[model samples]
Target: MNFVLKTILEEVRIRVFWILICFSFTWFTCYWFSEEFIFLLAKPFLTLPYLDSSFICTQLTEALSTYVTTSLISCFYFLFPFLSYQIWCFLMPSCYEEQRKKYNKLFYLSGFCFFLFFFVTFIWIVPNVWHFLYKLSTTSTNLLIIKLQPKIFDYIMLTVRILFISSICSQVPVLVICLLESKGVKTFIKNRRFFIVFSLFTAALFTPPDIWCQIVVCLPIYLIIELTIFYALIIQVYKRQLAL
Candidate 1:
C-alpha cells in the first residue's frame, strides 16, 4: 500500500510539473501579445460615439500592471481546454466506468457552454452595457460636461469581471441538469416557478443595473432550466417504457 501511494504521488508530481511548464510558456506568449488582447477587450468601448479610443493611466505602474493581469487572464482562458484535459487524465484512473462517462460528457458540455457565453458577453453584452453607460454621459447639459474619461486599469478590470461572470453563468444548464438527475424531473417541475424567480434574481445580481442587461442574462438561464426539465422528462419516460 505504501509503495502504491508513493507511485501515485510521483505520477501526480510529474503531471503537475508538466502542466506548470505549459502554463508558463502560454503565459509568456500571452504577455508578449498583451496589447492585442487589450485591444480586443477595448473594441466595444472604442466603438462608442464621442469617446476617444484611448484609455488614460494615472499611476506610472498602472499600465504595466494591467498588461500583466490581462496576459495572465488571457493565458488562463486559452489554456482552459488543455488544463481540463490534464485534470481529466489525473482523475480518470480513479473513476468507475459509468462515472468516467458522465464526467467526460460533463467536461465537454461545460466547456462548450463556457466559451459560448464568453463570446456572447464579448460580442453583445459588453457592447450594450458600455453603450448604455455612455448614454448616461450624454445627459450632460450645456453648463456641465459629463464626459467619460475611462482609466486603463478600471476598464480592463470591469471587462474581465463581466466576462468572468458570464462564463460562470453559462454553467446554469449543467447545474440544472445535475439537479434534475439527482432529484428527478417531477421535483424540478414542481419547483419550476422558484427556479425562474431565482434565475431572475441571480441575473440581476450579476448584470449591470439596466433592465435590458438583466433580461438578457435572465432569459438564457430561464431557457436552460426549462430545457433541462424537458430533457429529463423525456429520459424518464424512456426509462419507464424500457422497464415495461
Candidate 2:
C-alpha cells in the first residue's frame, strides 16, 4: 500500500511540474502574439455602427490586466493538446489495448472538434450575434442618438466566454461516441428523449439567459449527436460484415 501510494504521489508531482513548465513556456511564446490575437477578437466590435476601431481602457491597470489575462488564455489554448497528451501517457499504462485505442481516438477527436467550433464561433457566430444585438439594442431603445463604446476588458472577457462555451459544446460528438462504445448505441437510442432534455439544460447553463442564444448553442450539439449515431451504425455494420 505504501509503495502504491508513493508511486501515485511521484506521478502526480511529475505531472504538476511538467504542466507548470509547459504553461510557462507557452505563456511567454503566446504573449508575443497576444496583441494580434486580441486585435482579431476586437475586430467585430469595430464594424458596429457607432463603435470606433479603437478600444477604451477606463482603469489605469486595465491594459495590463487585459494583456495578462489574454496571454494566460492563449497559453492554455496552445497548451491543451500537450496537457491532454501528458494525461493520456500517465493513464495509458493502466489501460488495455481496446481502452487505449478508444482514448487515443478521443484525444485526436477532442482536439479537432474543439478547434473546429472555436473557429466557427469566432468567425461566424460572434460577429453575427454582435451584429444582431447591435441592431436590437439600437432599435429597441428608439433613441435619437445611440453609441456603443464597449470596454476593452469586457469585450475580451466576452470573447473568452464564447470560445470556452463553444469548445465545450464541440465535444458532444466525442462524448456521444464514447457513450456508444461503452454503453452501446441502443442505450442512447432508448434515452433519446432524456438526452434531448439534458441538451437543452446544458445549453441553458452555458449560454446567456436568452432563448435565441440557447438555441444557437443547442442546435449544433443536436446535429453532432445525430451524426455520431449515424457513424456508430455504419461502424456496427462494418463489424458485422467482417465477422461474417
For candidate 2, what is the TM-score? 0.86
lDDT of 1 by residue, 1-244 (tens): 9999999999889988988999999999999999999999999999877635568899999999999999999999988888888888989999999999998888889989998999889999999888987788665578877667789899999899889878867888889878877887878888889998988898888877989878887887788778877887888899999999
* Top TM-score model: 2
lDDT of candidate 1? 0.87
Give the winner by lDDT. Answer: 1
Clashes found in each candidate (C-alpha, N, C closer than 3 A): 0, 0
Residue pairs in candidate 1 whose N, alpha carbon or C atoms collide under 3 angstroms: none
Query: lDDT for every model?
Result: 0.87, 0.84
Worst 10 residues of 1 by lDDT: 137-146
Worst 10 residues of 2 by lDDT: 136-145
